[model samples]
Target: MRLVAAAVTFGAVLATLSGCGSDGPSGPVDAGGAQGRRAPGVTALPATDPTLIPDVGERLQRRIPADTGQVLVVYGEGENSPDSTAVFYMKEGPEWQRVARWAAHNGRKGWTVEHYSGDDRSPVGVFGLTDAGGVLDDPGSRLPYDQDYVAYAPTVNAVAYDHVFDYVIAIDYNRLPGTVPHNPTRPLGEDRGGGIWLHLDHGDGTSGCVSLPKGAMKFLLRTLDPAQHPVMVMGDERELRA
Candidate 1:
Protein backbone atom coordinates (compact mmCIF):
# COMPACT_ATOMS: atom_id res chain seq x y z
CA MET A 1 0.00 0.00 0.00
CA ARG A 2 2.79 2.41 0.91
CA LEU A 3 4.71 1.71 -2.28
CA VAL A 4 1.60 2.13 -4.38
CA ALA A 5 0.87 5.39 -2.64
CA ALA A 6 4.37 6.61 -3.27
CA ALA A 7 4.08 5.78 -6.96
CA VAL A 8 0.81 7.65 -7.25
CA THR A 9 2.20 10.71 -5.50
CA PHE A 10 5.29 10.71 -7.72
CA GLY A 11 3.15 10.57 -10.79
CA ALA A 12 0.88 13.33 -9.49
CA VAL A 13 3.80 15.58 -8.71
CA LEU A 14 5.20 14.97 -12.14
CA ALA A 15 1.90 15.63 -13.84
CA THR A 16 1.20 18.78 -11.89
CA LEU A 17 4.73 20.03 -12.35
CA SER A 18 4.55 19.45 -16.08
CA GLY A 19 1.41 21.57 -16.13
CA CYS A 20 1.71 24.22 -13.48
CA GLY A 21 -1.52 25.40 -11.91
CA SER A 22 -2.29 28.64 -10.04
CA ASP A 23 -5.24 27.48 -7.96
CA GLY A 24 -3.67 26.42 -4.66
CA PRO A 25 -3.05 28.75 -1.71
CA SER A 26 -5.42 31.66 -2.06
CA GLY A 27 -5.47 35.30 -0.86
CA PRO A 28 -2.41 37.51 -0.19
CA VAL A 29 0.88 36.21 1.26
CA ASP A 30 0.97 37.71 4.76
CA ALA A 31 4.41 36.34 5.88
CA GLY A 32 3.51 36.05 9.54
CA GLY A 33 1.77 33.16 11.32
CA ALA A 34 3.18 33.85 14.78
CA GLN A 35 1.35 36.18 17.12
CA GLY A 36 4.80 37.84 17.38
CA ARG A 37 3.95 39.90 20.42
CA ARG A 38 5.05 38.06 23.58
CA ALA A 39 2.32 37.08 25.98
CA PRO A 40 2.30 39.01 29.26
CA GLY A 41 4.99 37.70 31.66
CA VAL A 42 6.33 35.44 28.92
CA THR A 43 9.81 36.95 29.03
CA ALA A 44 11.80 34.73 26.68
CA LEU A 45 11.15 33.55 23.14
CA PRO A 46 10.19 29.88 23.26
CA ALA A 47 13.76 28.55 22.88
CA THR A 48 13.13 29.02 19.17
CA ASP A 49 14.73 32.07 17.67
CA PRO A 50 12.63 32.98 14.66
CA THR A 51 15.62 35.05 13.50
CA LEU A 52 18.10 32.16 13.68
CA ILE A 53 17.25 28.72 12.32
CA PRO A 54 20.21 26.30 12.39
CA ASP A 55 20.33 23.11 10.38
CA VAL A 56 21.79 20.83 13.05
CA GLY A 57 23.31 18.79 10.23
CA GLU A 58 20.13 16.82 10.64
CA ARG A 59 17.92 15.06 8.13
CA LEU A 60 14.90 16.51 6.30
CA GLN A 61 14.22 19.80 4.53
CA ARG A 62 10.97 21.07 2.99
CA ARG A 63 10.48 23.28 -0.04
CA ILE A 64 7.45 24.37 -2.04
CA PRO A 65 4.63 25.01 0.39
CA ALA A 66 5.19 28.21 2.38
CA ASP A 67 3.74 28.66 5.87
CA THR A 68 5.00 28.29 9.42
CA GLY A 69 3.34 25.92 11.80
CA GLN A 70 4.20 24.49 15.07
CA VAL A 71 5.73 22.84 11.93
CA LEU A 72 7.57 24.24 8.88
CA VAL A 73 6.30 24.15 5.27
CA VAL A 74 8.01 25.96 2.35
CA TYR A 75 6.73 26.38 -1.17
CA GLY A 76 7.56 28.46 -4.26
CA GLU A 77 11.31 27.92 -3.82
CA GLY A 78 11.81 26.05 -7.01
CA GLU A 79 10.07 24.77 -10.11
CA ASN A 80 7.23 23.93 -7.73
CA SER A 81 4.43 26.45 -7.81
CA PRO A 82 3.23 28.11 -4.63
CA ASP A 83 0.37 25.58 -4.51
CA SER A 84 1.33 22.74 -6.83
CA THR A 85 5.00 21.97 -6.11
CA ALA A 86 6.60 20.87 -2.82
CA VAL A 87 9.07 18.31 -1.47
CA PHE A 88 9.47 17.21 2.18
CA TYR A 89 12.86 15.71 3.04
CA MET A 90 14.37 14.35 6.23
CA LYS A 91 17.98 13.55 7.20
CA GLU A 92 18.33 9.84 7.81
CA GLY A 93 21.36 7.69 8.54
CA PRO A 94 23.92 9.59 6.46
CA GLU A 95 22.07 11.94 4.14
CA TRP A 96 18.95 14.05 3.89
CA GLN A 97 16.52 11.73 2.19
CA ARG A 98 13.36 12.74 0.40
CA VAL A 99 10.64 11.11 2.41
CA ALA A 100 8.00 12.67 0.25
CA ARG A 101 8.09 15.39 -2.36
CA TRP A 102 5.04 16.54 -4.28
CA ALA A 103 2.87 19.51 -5.28
CA ALA A 104 1.65 22.02 -2.67
CA HIS A 105 0.13 25.54 -2.23
CA ASN A 106 0.10 28.39 0.25
CA GLY A 107 -2.35 30.79 1.95
CA ARG A 108 -4.86 32.53 -0.28
CA LYS A 109 -5.27 35.32 2.22
CA GLY A 110 -1.53 35.61 1.55
CA TRP A 111 -0.39 35.87 5.19
CA THR A 112 -3.14 37.80 6.93
CA VAL A 113 -0.70 38.55 9.77
CA GLU A 114 -3.52 38.39 12.25
CA HIS A 115 -4.96 36.04 14.88
CA TYR A 116 -8.14 35.61 12.81
CA SER A 117 -7.31 36.45 9.19
CA GLY A 118 -6.19 32.88 8.50
CA ASP A 119 -3.41 34.41 6.45
CA ASP A 120 -0.87 34.39 9.24
CA ARG A 121 2.34 32.63 8.23
CA SER A 122 3.52 29.71 10.28
CA PRO A 123 5.52 30.60 13.39
CA VAL A 124 9.24 29.94 14.00
CA GLY A 125 10.23 28.70 17.47
CA VAL A 126 10.88 25.81 19.83
CA PHE A 127 7.61 24.29 21.10
CA GLY A 128 6.95 21.34 23.32
CA LEU A 129 7.10 17.99 21.57
CA THR A 130 3.92 16.11 22.34
CA ASP A 131 2.65 12.56 21.90
CA ALA A 132 -0.85 13.23 20.66
CA GLY A 133 -1.54 9.65 19.63
CA GLY A 134 -3.97 9.35 22.47
CA VAL A 135 -4.59 13.02 22.98
CA LEU A 136 -5.39 13.54 19.35
CA ASP A 137 -6.75 10.03 18.81
CA ASP A 138 -9.55 10.37 16.37
CA PRO A 139 -11.67 7.87 14.53
CA GLY A 140 -11.83 10.58 11.87
CA SER A 141 -8.12 10.08 11.05
CA ARG A 142 -5.49 7.33 10.84
CA LEU A 143 -2.30 9.27 11.56
CA PRO A 144 0.04 7.26 13.83
CA TYR A 145 -0.11 9.72 16.66
CA ASP A 146 0.26 6.70 18.97
CA GLN A 147 3.92 6.64 18.02
CA ASP A 148 6.33 9.59 18.27
CA TYR A 149 4.24 12.61 17.27
CA VAL A 150 4.13 16.31 18.02
CA ALA A 151 1.64 18.61 16.30
CA TYR A 152 0.32 22.15 16.82
CA ALA A 153 -3.01 22.59 15.07
CA PRO A 154 -4.92 24.69 17.58
CA THR A 155 -8.19 24.01 15.86
CA VAL A 156 -9.43 21.14 13.71
CA ASN A 157 -11.23 21.24 10.42
CA ALA A 158 -12.46 18.19 8.53
CA VAL A 159 -11.26 19.21 5.06
CA ALA A 160 -7.55 18.94 6.01
CA TYR A 161 -7.66 15.96 8.37
CA ASP A 162 -9.94 13.75 6.28
CA HIS A 163 -7.42 13.47 3.47
CA VAL A 164 -5.33 10.30 3.86
CA PHE A 165 -1.86 11.69 2.96
CA ASP A 166 -2.15 15.00 4.78
CA TYR A 167 0.00 15.80 7.85
CA VAL A 168 -0.46 19.09 9.70
CA ILE A 169 2.31 20.64 11.88
CA ALA A 170 1.26 23.67 13.93
CA ILE A 171 3.23 26.63 15.30
CA ASP A 172 2.72 27.93 18.83
CA TYR A 173 3.04 31.44 17.40
CA ASN A 174 -0.52 31.93 18.52
CA ARG A 175 -0.84 31.88 22.29
CA LEU A 176 -2.93 29.02 23.67
CA PRO A 177 -3.04 26.24 26.25
CA GLY A 178 -1.34 23.83 23.81
CA THR A 179 -0.85 20.05 24.04
CA VAL A 180 1.38 18.19 26.50
CA PRO A 181 4.90 16.83 25.99
CA HIS A 182 5.27 13.45 24.36
CA ASN A 183 8.97 13.04 25.02
CA PRO A 184 9.91 14.36 28.43
CA THR A 185 13.59 13.93 27.61
CA ARG A 186 14.24 17.16 25.73
CA PRO A 187 14.09 20.59 27.29
CA LEU A 188 10.35 21.17 27.87
CA GLY A 189 9.85 24.18 25.63
CA GLU A 190 12.86 23.56 23.36
CA ASP A 191 12.01 20.13 22.00
CA ARG A 192 8.73 20.84 20.22
CA GLY A 193 7.38 23.13 17.47
CA GLY A 194 6.23 26.25 19.34
CA GLY A 195 2.58 26.72 18.44
CA ILE A 196 3.71 25.30 15.12
CA TRP A 197 3.04 21.79 13.84
CA LEU A 198 3.17 19.91 10.53
CA HIS A 199 -0.24 18.85 9.33
CA LEU A 200 -2.29 17.98 6.22
CA ASP A 201 -3.13 20.56 3.59
CA HIS A 202 -6.62 21.59 2.67
CA GLY A 203 -7.18 22.80 -0.88
CA ASP A 204 -7.78 26.23 0.62
CA GLY A 205 -5.17 28.57 2.10
CA THR A 206 -4.38 27.88 5.76
CA SER A 207 -4.86 30.08 8.81
CA GLY A 208 -1.37 29.12 10.02
CA CYS A 209 -0.46 25.42 9.85
CA VAL A 210 1.62 24.29 6.83
CA SER A 211 -0.75 22.50 4.52
CA LEU A 212 0.13 19.89 1.91
CA PRO A 213 -1.26 17.03 -0.16
CA LYS A 214 -2.09 14.00 1.96
CA GLY A 215 0.82 11.75 0.88
CA ALA A 216 3.60 14.23 1.72
CA MET A 217 2.19 14.68 5.21
CA LYS A 218 1.93 10.95 6.05
CA PHE A 219 5.58 10.35 5.14
CA LEU A 220 6.61 13.28 7.35
CA LEU A 221 4.77 12.16 10.48
CA ARG A 222 5.83 8.52 10.18
CA THR A 223 9.53 9.21 9.62
CA LEU A 224 10.19 12.22 11.86
CA ASP A 225 12.73 11.96 14.74
CA PRO A 226 12.77 14.00 17.94
CA ALA A 227 16.41 13.50 18.91
CA GLN A 228 17.53 15.59 15.97
CA HIS A 229 15.51 18.38 17.58
CA PRO A 230 13.96 18.90 14.18
CA VAL A 231 13.91 22.49 13.02
CA MET A 232 11.41 23.99 10.57
CA VAL A 233 13.22 26.58 8.37
CA MET A 234 11.04 29.38 7.00
CA GLY A 235 11.63 32.85 5.56
CA ASP A 236 12.07 34.52 2.20
CA GLU A 237 12.47 32.01 -0.64
CA ARG A 238 16.20 32.78 -0.89
CA GLU A 239 16.94 32.36 2.83
CA LEU A 240 14.89 29.26 3.74
CA ARG A 241 15.95 26.35 1.50
CA ALA A 242 19.44 27.59 0.69
Candidate 2:
Protein backbone atom coordinates (compact mmCIF):
# COMPACT_ATOMS: atom_id res chain seq x y z
CA MET A 1 0.00 0.00 0.00
CA ARG A 2 1.19 3.48 -0.87
CA LEU A 3 1.65 5.56 2.24
CA VAL A 4 0.06 8.95 2.38
CA ALA A 5 1.83 11.79 4.14
CA ALA A 6 0.10 13.09 7.24
CA ALA A 7 -0.58 16.63 8.34
CA VAL A 8 0.88 17.22 11.76
CA THR A 9 2.15 20.44 13.30
CA PHE A 10 4.83 20.37 15.99
CA GLY A 11 5.71 22.97 18.58
CA ALA A 12 8.50 25.47 17.95
CA VAL A 13 12.08 24.95 19.08
CA LEU A 14 14.01 27.67 20.89
CA ALA A 15 17.74 27.78 20.28
CA THR A 16 20.20 29.48 22.60
CA LEU A 17 22.78 30.10 19.94
CA SER A 18 25.72 32.30 20.94
CA GLY A 19 25.17 34.17 17.69
CA CYS A 20 27.80 35.54 15.27
CA GLY A 21 31.36 35.59 16.64
CA SER A 22 34.79 34.08 16.39
CA ASP A 23 35.73 30.78 14.77
CA GLY A 24 35.00 27.34 16.20
CA PRO A 25 35.51 26.52 19.86
CA SER A 26 39.12 27.09 20.83
CA GLY A 27 40.86 24.14 22.43
CA PRO A 28 39.30 20.83 23.34
CA VAL A 29 37.01 20.95 26.32
CA ASP A 30 35.46 17.88 27.83
CA ALA A 31 31.79 17.53 26.96
CA GLY A 32 30.30 19.40 29.90
CA GLY A 33 33.74 19.36 31.58
CA ALA A 34 34.96 16.26 33.53
CA GLN A 35 33.38 12.88 33.01
CA GLY A 36 29.86 12.57 34.48
CA ARG A 37 29.72 16.37 35.04
CA ARG A 38 27.15 18.25 32.91
CA ALA A 39 27.67 21.59 31.24
CA PRO A 40 25.48 24.44 32.43
CA GLY A 41 23.59 24.50 29.13
CA VAL A 42 23.95 24.49 25.35
CA THR A 43 27.14 26.16 24.20
CA ALA A 44 26.13 28.72 21.59
CA LEU A 45 28.36 28.24 18.57
CA PRO A 46 29.01 30.84 15.90
CA ALA A 47 26.73 29.80 13.06
CA THR A 48 26.94 33.37 11.78
CA ASP A 49 30.26 32.77 10.07
CA PRO A 50 28.79 29.87 8.11
CA THR A 51 32.43 28.90 7.88
CA LEU A 52 32.02 27.55 11.39
CA ILE A 53 29.01 25.60 12.43
CA PRO A 54 28.88 25.52 16.23
CA ASP A 55 31.28 22.91 17.39
CA VAL A 56 29.56 20.13 19.33
CA GLY A 57 32.89 19.81 21.22
CA GLU A 58 36.10 17.90 20.56
CA ARG A 59 35.04 14.40 21.48
CA LEU A 60 31.92 14.51 19.30
CA GLN A 61 33.15 16.69 16.46
CA ARG A 62 36.25 14.55 16.04
CA ARG A 63 34.09 11.70 14.84
CA ILE A 64 32.85 13.77 11.88
CA PRO A 65 35.13 13.99 8.89
CA ALA A 66 36.10 17.32 7.37
CA ASP A 67 34.92 16.18 3.94
CA THR A 68 31.44 15.24 5.06
CA GLY A 69 29.00 17.30 2.96
CA GLN A 70 25.74 16.96 4.84
CA VAL A 71 24.96 16.95 8.56
CA LEU A 72 21.71 16.73 10.52
CA VAL A 73 22.16 18.05 14.05
CA VAL A 74 19.50 16.97 16.56
CA TYR A 75 19.67 18.97 19.79
CA GLY A 76 17.43 17.86 22.62
CA GLU A 77 16.24 20.67 24.90
CA GLY A 78 17.50 18.93 28.03
CA GLU A 79 18.91 15.66 29.27
CA ASN A 80 15.40 14.27 29.28
CA SER A 81 13.23 16.47 27.11
CA PRO A 82 10.95 14.77 24.60
CA ASP A 83 11.42 17.70 22.25
CA SER A 84 14.42 18.89 20.26
CA THR A 85 15.55 20.65 17.10
CA ALA A 86 16.78 18.95 13.96
CA VAL A 87 18.72 21.19 11.64
CA PHE A 88 19.94 20.25 8.20
CA TYR A 89 23.24 21.71 7.02
CA MET A 90 25.12 21.42 3.77
CA LYS A 91 28.81 22.08 3.31
CA GLU A 92 29.19 24.72 0.63
CA GLY A 93 32.77 25.42 -0.35
CA PRO A 94 34.61 26.08 2.95
CA GLU A 95 31.55 26.63 5.12
CA TRP A 96 28.28 24.99 6.09
CA GLN A 97 24.91 26.53 5.36
CA ARG A 98 21.79 25.94 7.41
CA VAL A 99 19.19 24.78 4.93
CA ALA A 100 16.28 24.16 7.28
CA ARG A 101 15.51 23.63 10.93
CA TRP A 102 12.52 21.74 12.30
CA ALA A 103 11.19 20.78 15.70
CA ALA A 104 11.20 17.08 16.52
CA HIS A 105 10.34 14.46 19.11
CA ASN A 106 12.97 12.19 20.51
CA GLY A 107 12.83 9.28 22.93
CA ARG A 108 10.43 9.80 25.83
CA LYS A 109 13.19 9.70 28.46
CA GLY A 110 15.67 11.74 26.35
CA TRP A 111 19.22 10.52 25.56
CA THR A 112 21.78 8.01 26.77
CA VAL A 113 25.17 6.59 25.77
CA GLU A 114 24.35 3.11 26.97
CA HIS A 115 21.37 2.57 24.62
CA TYR A 116 19.52 -0.71 24.71
CA SER A 117 16.36 -2.06 23.16
CA GLY A 118 13.13 -0.57 24.62
CA ASP A 119 15.29 1.96 26.50
CA ASP A 120 13.00 4.87 25.62
CA ARG A 121 16.16 6.99 25.32
CA SER A 122 17.87 8.04 22.13
CA PRO A 123 21.56 7.35 21.72
CA VAL A 124 23.94 10.28 22.01
CA GLY A 125 26.68 10.79 19.42
CA VAL A 126 27.35 11.15 15.68
CA PHE A 127 26.19 8.48 13.27
CA GLY A 128 25.98 8.09 9.50
CA LEU A 129 22.76 8.47 7.44
CA THR A 130 22.88 5.60 5.01
CA ASP A 131 19.41 4.39 4.09
CA ALA A 132 15.81 5.41 3.51
CA GLY A 133 12.45 3.64 3.21
CA GLY A 134 8.76 3.74 4.10
CA VAL A 135 5.32 2.44 3.19
CA LEU A 136 5.36 4.94 0.36
CA ASP A 137 7.27 4.72 -2.86
CA ASP A 138 10.67 6.35 -3.36
CA PRO A 139 10.60 10.10 -2.83
CA GLY A 140 13.76 10.74 -4.89
CA SER A 141 16.08 10.07 -1.93
CA ARG A 142 19.69 9.32 -2.69
CA LEU A 143 19.80 6.58 -0.08
CA PRO A 144 18.49 3.15 -0.97
CA TYR A 145 14.78 2.82 -0.21
CA ASP A 146 13.03 -0.21 1.22
CA GLN A 147 9.27 -0.35 0.75
CA ASP A 148 7.39 -3.04 2.60
CA TYR A 149 4.34 -3.41 4.85
CA VAL A 150 6.04 -5.03 7.81
CA ALA A 151 9.09 -2.89 7.27
CA TYR A 152 7.16 0.17 8.36
CA ALA A 153 4.46 -1.42 10.49
CA PRO A 154 3.89 -0.56 14.13
CA THR A 155 2.76 -3.22 16.57
CA VAL A 156 0.35 -0.74 18.08
CA ASN A 157 -2.87 0.49 16.53
CA ALA A 158 -2.90 2.39 13.23
CA VAL A 159 -3.65 5.65 15.03
CA ALA A 160 -0.32 5.56 16.83
CA TYR A 161 1.50 4.25 13.75
CA ASP A 162 -0.22 6.16 11.00
CA HIS A 163 2.14 8.05 8.73
CA VAL A 164 4.96 7.32 11.16
CA PHE A 165 6.97 5.65 8.43
CA ASP A 166 5.70 7.44 5.37
CA TYR A 167 9.28 8.62 5.21
CA VAL A 168 12.28 7.26 7.14
CA ILE A 169 15.98 7.95 6.95
CA ALA A 170 17.96 5.26 8.67
CA ILE A 171 20.45 6.51 11.22
CA ASP A 172 23.41 4.16 10.94
CA TYR A 173 23.78 3.83 14.67
CA ASN A 174 24.30 0.09 14.85
CA ARG A 175 23.06 -1.24 11.49
CA LEU A 176 24.91 -1.46 8.20
CA PRO A 177 24.22 0.49 5.02
CA GLY A 178 24.01 -0.75 1.37
CA THR A 179 21.52 -3.24 2.78
CA VAL A 180 17.79 -3.06 3.50
CA PRO A 181 17.02 -0.89 6.53
CA HIS A 182 15.03 -3.71 8.13
CA ASN A 183 17.91 -6.17 7.96
CA PRO A 184 18.01 -6.24 11.78
CA THR A 185 21.56 -7.53 11.66
CA ARG A 186 22.92 -4.94 14.03
CA PRO A 187 26.67 -4.89 14.23
CA LEU A 188 26.28 -3.58 17.77
CA GLY A 189 24.79 -7.00 18.62
CA GLU A 190 21.18 -5.70 18.84
CA ASP A 191 21.46 -5.16 22.61
CA ARG A 192 23.60 -2.05 22.32
CA GLY A 193 20.75 -0.54 20.20
CA GLY A 194 19.57 -0.48 16.61
CA GLY A 195 16.77 0.57 14.13
CA ILE A 196 17.16 4.23 14.96
CA TRP A 197 15.71 6.48 12.23
CA LEU A 198 14.47 9.93 11.29
CA HIS A 199 10.79 9.30 10.69
CA LEU A 200 7.45 11.16 10.49
CA ASP A 201 6.23 12.58 13.78
CA HIS A 202 3.23 10.99 15.48
CA GLY A 203 2.69 13.93 17.83
CA ASP A 204 4.40 12.08 20.63
CA GLY A 205 7.73 10.75 21.86
CA THR A 206 9.27 7.72 20.15
CA SER A 207 10.57 4.51 21.65
CA GLY A 208 14.11 5.32 20.49
CA CYS A 209 13.70 7.03 17.13
CA VAL A 210 13.63 10.69 16.20
CA SER A 211 10.40 11.97 14.65
CA LEU A 212 10.03 15.07 12.49
CA PRO A 213 6.98 16.50 10.81
CA LYS A 214 6.00 14.76 7.58
CA GLY A 215 7.03 17.74 5.49
CA ALA A 216 10.41 17.92 7.17
CA MET A 217 10.84 14.18 6.72
CA LYS A 218 10.10 14.58 3.04
CA PHE A 219 12.53 17.47 2.80
CA LEU A 220 15.18 15.36 4.51
CA LEU A 221 14.57 12.43 2.19
CA ARG A 222 14.79 14.57 -0.92
CA THR A 223 17.80 16.55 0.31
CA LEU A 224 20.00 14.05 2.15
CA ASP A 225 22.31 12.95 -0.70
CA PRO A 226 24.20 9.79 0.12
CA ALA A 227 27.11 10.76 -2.13
CA GLN A 228 27.62 13.80 0.10
CA HIS A 229 28.50 11.64 3.11
CA PRO A 230 25.68 12.62 5.39
CA VAL A 231 25.86 12.15 9.15
CA MET A 232 23.75 13.09 12.16
CA VAL A 233 25.03 14.73 15.36
CA MET A 234 22.64 14.07 18.21
CA GLY A 235 22.58 14.58 21.99
CA ASP A 236 21.13 16.71 24.76
CA GLU A 237 21.97 20.43 24.86
CA ARG A 238 24.54 20.10 27.66
CA GLU A 239 25.85 16.76 26.48
CA LEU A 240 26.29 18.29 23.04
CA ARG A 241 28.46 21.07 24.41
CA ALA A 242 30.07 18.72 26.83
Listed per candidate, the RMSD to the true structure in angstroms reads 13.6, 11.6
Off by over 4 Å in 2: 1-45
Q: Report model 1's TM-score to 2 decimal places.
A: 0.42
Q: Candidates' TM-scores?
A: 0.42, 0.79
Encode model 2's per-residue lDDT on 94-159: one tens digit a residue: 666555566678999999988999889999998998888998888677678888877788656868
Summarize candidate 1's per-residue lDDT along 28-48 as a digit string, tens digits.
111111113221111222313
What lDDT does each candidate get?
Answer: 0.34, 0.69
Error of 1 at 164 (Å): 9.6
- Candidate 2: C-alpha RMSD to true structure equals 11.6
Candidate 2 worst ten-residue window by lDDT: 5-14
